[model samples]
Target: MRDLTVAVFRPDDERLEDAVELIDSLGATAVPDPMLAVEPTGSPPRTDADCVVLTSKTGAELVADAGWEPGEATVCAIGPRTADALREVGYDVDTVPEEYTSSGLVATLEGAVDGARVEVARSDHGSPVLLDGLEAAGAYVHETVLYRLVRPAGSGDSTERAAAGTLDAACFTSSLTVEHWLEAADERGNRDEALEGLTEATVGVIGEPTRETAADAGIDVDLVASEATFDALACETVEAAAPTYHE
Candidate 1:
């Protein structure tokens, strides 16, 4: 079995180190070229919501940065990573759905949030599933965009590698990563070639929603982790690319 190179397109945050460690554990070279930068939009408005929902680790960090304390309000996170982020900043999370998607969060809050007040903090580009569902379920939802995702400057190396067909697999944690990666390839005048190259390589995504998003953008996802976390995505990538696993 030849050593594989897995290109990781994510933010250069603590999670990036986790992905690198997981790839190294599988004896593969991890090429981490962060594609997106998370920028806090602004300080969130003062709210008296009964519950606070955080959908991403960046959102948790942003809320903490805004100096908002979840006093008596219930803190609900979308997944373990987000929950950990909130916990690390001194908030005890009250709920984390078995599934990590917005739909899953909505399902968990449906019966519990009737006639309640909820504040949701997430990215500006976040989907409306959770917000809309909560509102429909009788929660007065105060949705705030705490952060925004933008393509980082001078981070096109992984896209170039993909264009050159040098990567064995690429792990995309979000749909934006796929979009930004292809946009970078297009900027280099190699969009078509990069798309072809990606078709030959394994595409690992964090969850079904991201896989659907990638597929909508013409990327055929080869692996999808059962859980929506970097570690799970890295493991799925290894399983798809490891020669011993194939044998």
Candidate 2:
């Protein structure tokens, strides 16, 4: 298949099945092998936090799973996708920045931090920018790890998918996914081959920071979404890959 294949760097768990199917329907193969594990700690100590911050769909999904209602707190999401996820479960998203990242969220947090209590729901590998920024602004910042970024023992189903040669491209949504994919492939003794395939294949990232990480590792990004959202990413991917087959 000359059509682009999108290796979804999400975990092979059942949670992402819908997304995989959706991508596959676009005439692209979807390979799932998560570089991160989302761990829910249930509801943490909810303080008098004036606002709630979400960094990813994982964080928003964790909030949805906790079944807790926000009480007089503003909800700030890093991007439109995270905000949509939060809103899907009846959480009102109060802020979404044009640029998507914890650092971007930190910039927006400065003005809002005055006399406010803020809590961040994010992964164990979350950046310190948001937490540090809020603390510096004199807002009490609370945070809990809702996930862990870890590599698997092997390539998982991705290796089989790769060998099929239907794969044309792969999308790395986060830095952890890129790192963990390499780490996991290394454990399987196919690290070099995998790296070669990834490098030769069309590589797409979700945003600038992730692109920086991939580029630093010598992977050139073929495409990046204009907006940092799943819908945007998927659309951009399909657009980027569509021209190769349409001719």
Candidate 3:
């Protein structure tokens, strides 16, 4: 069998081992080239708000890291996994979108936002779409940067092969993963050739935004999980790409 290389651009250390296990089960080499590295913010905010919006599991973990818990106010999550994470830490999630995205979550809000205060717990580098949309809905948005996502230092030789068109697929969990991969490709001077032939290979994305980012980068997404969790994404990638490998 030809050796298949699949890069998992996972930013979180907590999720890397599981991603590796799943990728290895597919008989493909998994590369740990993290495009985004997360580091926690100093502390959770002290101000009280009417609601808290969590955009990622990373955000929920940060809240736990800060030793804070949601009290009285409603907690809204962008997806089920995020809500589950919050629930693990004792938060009562009031809203979670069927589609795992900020736009979808914002659309599912309970009441008029006028006079309500909402705090968004997320990475400093994350998109401001949710906060802006919430404010536009008349909720006072308190933006808290609970973590920062930075690109990891080295991506190694397999990434070079991936850029050179030898790899079969790549996995993306966040829109930033696609952005950072493209940036890394640019830095390595492989941008043009990489995108042109990217569609020939499979791309696995976690959510709508990541899928859209893959499409914007001219890569065809061949797999997206029914659920937005890391495990679900990895399983979907293997299940979707297994037939091709066997054939």
Task: List the pairs of residues colliding in candidate 1.
Answer: none
TM agreement with the true structure for every prediction: 0.93, 0.82, 0.84
How far out, in Å, is residue 99 in model 3? 2.5
lDDT of 1 by residue, 1-247 (tens): 4568899977888777877888999888898988889888796834687988988888887778788887788889999989999899878999999998899999998999999999988888777888899999999999888888999887768767777877788899888888888778877888877788788788899877788888988888998888888888888887787753331
Please name the candidate that would achieve the greatest lDDT relative to the true structure: 1
> Per-residue lDDT for 1-247 in model 2, tens only?
3446677766656546865887877777666666666556665526467888878777777767776667888888888878888888788899997678777787877877877878887878887777888888778788867766566555445544544444567777778777776666656666666666665566778888788888887677898878776556766776776776542
Q: Is candidate 1 or candidate 3 better by TM-score?
A: 1
lDDT for model 3, please.
0.76
Clashing pairs in 3: none
Highest TM-score: give the candidate number: 1
Cα lDDT tens digits, model 3, 31-91, are: 7777888777676854588888888878887788778767777888888878888888777
Error of 2 at 180 (Å): 1.0
Model 1 misplacement above 4 A: 244-247
Ranking by lDDT: 1, 3, 2
